[model samples]
Target: MSTETSVTPSLDRAMCAELDAADPLASFRDRFALPEGVIYLDGNSLGALPKDTAAHVQRVITEEWGDGLIRSWNDAGWFAKPVALGDRLAPLIGAAPGEVVLGDSTSASLFQTAVAAVRLRPGRRVVVSERGNFPTDLYMLEAVQELLGGGEPLERRLIHDDGPTLDDVLDDDVAVVVLTHVDYRTGRMRDLAEVTRQVQAVGALMLWDLCHSVGAVPVDLNAAGADFAIGCTYKYLNGGPGAPSFIWVAERHHAAARPALTGWHGHARPFDFELGYAPAEGITRFRVGTPQLLSVAALEASLDIWSEVDLDAIREKSLRLTELFISLVDARLAPWGIGVASPRQSARRGSQVALRVDDGFAVMQALIERGVIGDFRAPDLMRFGFAPLYVSHTDVWDAVANLEDILSTEVWREARFARRGAVT
Candidate 1:
């Protein structure tokens, strides 16, 4: 039997083959070590391993940790990885050399940025954010506010729509407007440039959560006049799980913003052991604790791959992959109540598509058993992420074919597929 189906003309196997042939990023698939029989479509949540990562990790463990020991901080350049990696990543996100710093988790970075932003705009206690933002961003702000005080004493405003206007909430009383550049659930992208301008008009600082935007989208933090931003490397950047996250403070704010969680490493002169709390110059001041060596090593290995490719090319191929997934899935699964929840327009969507289906969890389980790995969110949303670096147009076609087979044969309707797990 042929792996062919009659659907939208653009979604056919022939069209996918043509797209694969024309793809500039086609060769990049070999750079990753994906399983032989699996079509991995969850790169938005956790990226697949790069082929070079294992060897790099082994060298770090054997040479740096075993042989160099404490001296590795100087000889192997271990102490400077945060700043050095930040410099390497700056170009990918359109930032300057001293603007970005790598450390901690996305939650920690958000808290640091939020605290600095509120402090910068003293007497203005309000933090404006969207209701649909990632839960961690909202929770972190709430925790920060509670630690400072109680009740509505520290105002927290939540926006509810995707419209162009935010001027209503961007008032003088608002100290910071914390926003995620790309909506995590719906995959809807916001206008970063316009939003930055609006927030600045009210004399309020903007702290962007680039967790979904950073490697997948073209972000010009400096050009957009953005004040602060934070993101994780495990997603589109392909850093391994639990890898350290990154934060960016514009060159102007580097000297002004003060980090709350100051540590010995962030001291101006660590060996001097000064009693007073003097911060290091520029972005170095934001480094609050000792860096995670193993995780940082993994992230550096991933960054090596990122340095070779152009982000614009990555964005182009990402859009093509998502478009193909949507076009194919809609034709095959719409009859079963699977509706597209992500933005249809390429410009307004990120690198993923969320399909709304009544039995999303079961459908996803069935697909997983068939070697097509995607994930499901709450309240009927099947999320598929297309990482252009390792995912190909042919992989998209195979994933959709597996979905069609599962739905047509009633394989997903089995009661055994409904068991809930700790993590999705």
Candidate 2:
């Protein structure tokens, strides 16, 4: 495929209709419960809700919890949901069943895996990561360092490499290399296989934060030889907000890897109620605490819809949608000082396309008011995500049309739109 296969889009709705008609995934749009008149481009931030989620949550509350109470943990199979959900999600990222499990928040998962990686290589005293990584990652790493880094002189070296490759950073001193698979702000992608190989070659383990790469992009965790990985389900997975994050540890590290946050649930035999903690065999050990039952139930409902869907189709549609948005923005919005901050090449980018624009927060707020719901990142980036399962080509075309109208009329300059919200 061309680096950026551009689509002029004819500046017309008919073209979008034609594209939609040809889309194999078109019928899936009705499966979501998006608000009327809204073109949701924020799935990269929070996914659109699946139609079955509410009913499932109701059942969990009314039947499982209300009636069965504590017995529901066994009867309703609540205890096994994390592993089951992880199995369902495995193929999406090309991971095997026993390698992944869901629990805890993304930050917590990152902390566990990083600590374990450091412990595995006691002599190594440095953890190398990108300076541009999401703040939570750097914060979590710093937290890990303070707890573990003592007289031995440990360092959390944040590299500012302009390129994705860590040619200058990976070394024997580095116990583990932490990097996000896709950049959160700019939507740029890293070569996972290449990076993993390089890290391992230097005797350092590789841990990837797959938050932005899991659903929209295809990741072969085992194929890339990635030692460890962690990701959230709430984005393109369509899992509800605060849905548990998942962690994947290579089978080789299962016996050696010991997470710091050892809870009763992660214990090998919780029923035994032993005095000391013995981690459960396999991925079950990654369980942090009692599962967030209702949220996981909601996620199960979402995953049920995802069970039959092919990820290749999702990746294919994502590129098409983003390519359309980029082309439209380049052709129409450059004069407004709105330029693509993300990679122009589809292969080099994730599912979201970020635009560097003046007053990005205000512009995104304006777009939201106009019913185009993308989001703003700090320091001038407006990100729009394309989730193929529900978002149609017509939605993309209409969103672009709305943006063009708003830019041309200077609707973004309104004082109400300029006023910032706490969340943005």
Candidate 3:
């Protein structure tokens, strides 16, 4: 038997077609409900809807909710949906069953896990996180600091590319370190196992925010020996808007882990009508309250598709797509001062690439108008996410081609594009 190897193909549209024809996951593209003529490059922000999502939600509404009503909590297994879905999601991130459970939003999950992680290490008063982390994570951490702090908030230390490296900030006083596995804006990935080792060596717990890495890149939380993790289902997971987040606690941590929220769902004997709260065993202790069942239904449908996916294959295709897009941008768009903002090395990059360009907000607006949809970050970064399940080599070529045409024509300077939306 021979091992197949990947080779870089020349820059050509016909070559892209050849690559697509040979793609093992090409058939999976039809499973998504993308609009006609729209090359979606924003799966990192919000995933395209799965074709089965609507029917699945509809069945849950008409049969489970409408017909079954209250009986559905048990008969339809609605009560167990969060833990059950977490078990299904475990494999994608190298987690074990009973070690992961769904939570509210990513912010809420971070607060839940961060508080518990801090409590695990008493006497340590400092929390470490990246300056580049998603704003919500930092925001939630602020609340954690105040709530846990005795009159004074816990000191927060930020590590950045420019100064005060992780080594500089690590000390005996650090309680927990929360960092995103893959940076949300620049698409840079961290060495999970290595960072875990570094944090643990200094007597600090490492909690990962895997929002961008879970479905797009290869992650092995247990293998990395991480203490805690939380990620959302709405992005590459394609669970639809406002889907729930999930939290993973190492089996070893369950015995001593104390979640901040003591909602009835986490109570060991909820139906007993006890006045006091006693958390349930294992991952169930992290649950705050009743889950959004309809949203969980949508996630359930998406997980069905994920059950058959190969993470290694997804990683391979992701690198291919990102590499292709970067190459095209460098070759064609560099004349307009557009440069790749993400790491050039595939090992250090995730499934998305960020491009640095002038007037990026307007340029992204123009790109969206032309149907090559990506997104813009605050100062000057245009992010393009390549979901291997749907985005193809041809899509990469077309996106760059569209971007080039927009830059050359100066259409991005138009008044309509300059108008900013509340979300962006």
Q: Please give each candidate's TM-score.
A: 0.95, 0.97, 0.98
Residue 161's C-alpha lDDT in candidate 3?
Answer: 95
lDDT of 1 by residue, 1-424 (tens): 1112223644577778887889888888898999999888888899989998989988999999999999999999987888889999999888999888897999998998888888888888788899888999999999767654445557888888864347667688888899999888878899899989989998999999998887898899999999999999999888899988998999898777877678777778877988888899989888877899888888888899888898889888888788778878777776776788998877888888998878889999999988889899898989998888888888888888888888889889999889989988
List the candidate 2 regions with Cα displacement exceeding 4 Å.
Answer: 9-11, 161-165
RMSD of each: 3.5, 1.4, 2.1
What would you estimate as the lDDT of candidate 1? 0.86
Q: Model 2 residue 53 lDDT?
A: 94
Residues 1-424, candidate 3: write the lDDT tens digits.
1112133435699999998999988989999999999999999999999999999999999999999999999999999999999999999999999999999999999999999999999999999998999999999999999999998999999999997899999999999999999999999999999999999999999999999998999899999999999999999999999999999999999989999998999989999989898989999999988899999999999999999999999998898888888878878887898878898888888889999887999999999998989999989999999999999899999999999999999999999998987887
TM-score of 3: 0.98
lDDT of 2 by residue, 167-194 (tens): 7777789899999999998899999999
Instruction: Give the local distance difference test score of model 3.
Output: 0.93
- Better model by lDDT, 2 or 3? 3
Mark the regions of model 3 whose C-alpha exceeds 4 Å error after superposition: 1-10
- Model 1: CA > 4 A from native: 1-10, 149-153, 162-165
Q: What are the lDDT scores of the predictions, listed in order?
A: 0.86, 0.87, 0.93
